[model samples]
Target: MHFLKAATIAILSPLVSATCTPWSTPGTCTATSSSCDFYTCLESKSGCGPTGYELGYALPFCNAITAVSSNLSVNGQAWYSATKLCLQNALSVEASCETSCTNIYLNAFASHVPCYLDSGFCELSGADLKVFFQVVGVAGVTSNDGLALFGAVLQGCVTKYQNGQVNMGWTKWLVRTLNGEI
Candidate 1:
């Protein structure tokens, strides 16, 4: 009986190991890139954008911004600084970093909506507004030609999060917002 039990354990070990694949970490920006382009990094399959299950780990927009800032050229650094400033100002206006704000900007670009001009949404004036537009233009968010490039993936994540199929940090916020609790 002991021998039979040992044989069964040995036989099942390899099968279990083979069947259970480990989770892979998402890719980040390359340190050797000539120029740091946020859109390219965000949209690339193996770049800063997290696909499927990886979305539960961190906010994709923030991740991409961090990755792109890792190794930036002089011009890239300038753009990064302006972008950070614009993002900070925007966040101060009740916009959430973990929510769909980033994607909304991208979507606005697709919908031909000048988000900066939306006083109710932007609320930025003068220099801040100018910088905001500059950053948005440089990030290529306004030049997408009406394509919701990341819409499908973002929608899938939202659906999965709403259904409790994923454990993202923003799930509670999303749920409350959807239920009109916020």
Candidate 2:
């Protein structure tokens, strides 16, 4: 049910259909001709605007371990709460970072504690997001050092969609799965 609701929201949001187009001057070209025109120029280029678009990730208060066998995963409501707060904060920080740093690749990231029996280290050591982001020249950071390395892996995943790589989001995935569409 929770997944269903999230899926609904994701489907409704305009963010999914949003696409970046290049800038062009008026009277650039005509509709019937192959010559340059506003519409044609827009179609040829797909890059962010001068300020660039912002990307954010909300950290859900999910348990470090999701146990399918025992169905003992953390509460989805609590996880969503943390995710909302974390994503908002991440966007804020990203805006600031973009303003302060040159060549700032605008991306949002978050790292949170998981409620697993074992220490987070033992449970999360295998996260592979770092390698993903390293290929793109971005590093993911977490508020907690212990979560930093692992956090990068998550950020790596997030960055994978940087410049609009994926058409669907986590919420969409959940909805599709729940609807027997996956």
Candidate 3:
């Protein structure tokens, strides 16, 4: 029933879709688009962006990470949460990380991601997001291990995406799976 509801909703709802799409105007795109654009750029490795548009993740390798980490806090948060969920579903077979802390982390992220202005800049900092991910794995010393694993998994996903192994998100996969369409 839950799957049905989600699938129905997904099928009926409008969706955001883009890859290597151009957003020539700075502040004109939503954070979701900004993040997607960023991801597309990163995934391209050698080159990206449309013919006439400036690339979103054009900074040098290290600076691109810094820009995504510090400048686009919501994108960072989204990356963290999305990576976590992907790991929980794909690799953490016997272990699940969806505790209250996870909800809190996601909620904290939600508050920070929605206010994209025309400048492609968000006012939030990555420090808060860093702190949020640190506490999500588990409680006590176990949490330290969980946090480390979580970080590794997130980085691995990023690496795989950059290497052209995976998509940046799993919502569509979830929807297809739930509807027995995967």
Candidate 4:
């Protein structure tokens, strides 16, 4: 009887502890998995980038964001929507200009830092928060920690732009446009 119980436990252990790999393709993972956070699993195995910008990255990321946010409270949905828009716009700009536009893209996206911090994004916990940081490439940070990281990066961009270490005329225009000030 003892030997049988040990064998059964060993047989089931791997199934119970299995971790889902981050999604490489849509529909590969779903929220039903008890051990997987859907959003964390949406992080691209091939990475989101200027190279395969659309089909490979933006579409997958935005789709996952939309899917998850659809199930959240209204405030949470708004937060995710804003985040999606920011990335979409920034990535579009980067794709158009390649590496030359990287800083501008970063700064333009960073301009939304305040909004992300103040919005329902800060209210996220558990899986939602995990998803947020996973997309940010540093999975498992608290909302405060994530916002701090954004703030630090934004501050760095501001200092660099101020010191004339980087050019950002286009970024200024992009930020203005995004804010509806244009």
Tell me, by lDDT, which candidate is best.
4
Q: For candidate 4, list the clashing residue pairs, or say none.
A: none
Superposed on all Cα atoms, model 3 deviates from the true structure by an RMSD in Å of: 18.8
Overall lDDT per candidate, in order of appearance: 0.35, 0.29, 0.33, 0.43
Q: Per-residue CA lDDT of candidate 3, range 1-182, in tens?
A: 22233234334433634233332333321123223343233224323334211232112322334344443356555554453333222211111212222222222222221221112112123464344434322351145433443343444444444555554354234334656997
Cα lDDT tens digits, model 1, 1-182, are 22233334435634763222221334442322223342332334323244321232223443554554535444444544544334333322112212233332332222222111121112222343344334334444423321232232234445666666655344445556777999
Judge candidate 3 at residue 50 and give its lDDT: 41
Which regions of candidate 3 are displaced past 4 Å?
Answer: 1-72, 88-125, 137-144, 147-182
State candidate 1's TM-score.
0.24
**For each candidate, C-alpha RMSD in Å?**
18.7, 18.5, 18.8, 19.2
- Model 4 is weakest, by summed lDDT over 10 consecutive residues, at 31-40
Best by TM-score: 4
> Judged by lDDT relative to the true structure, which candidate is superior, 2 or 4?
4
lDDT of 2 by residue, 1-182 (tens): 22233334334643655333323333221222111132222223323344322211111111121112123223332333344344333333222221322112222221222211111212112222122223223333333332453444334434433434433445235335656999
| TM-score to true structure, per model | 0.24, 0.22, 0.20, 0.35
lDDT of model 4 at residue 113?
Answer: 49
Pairs clashing within candidate 1: none
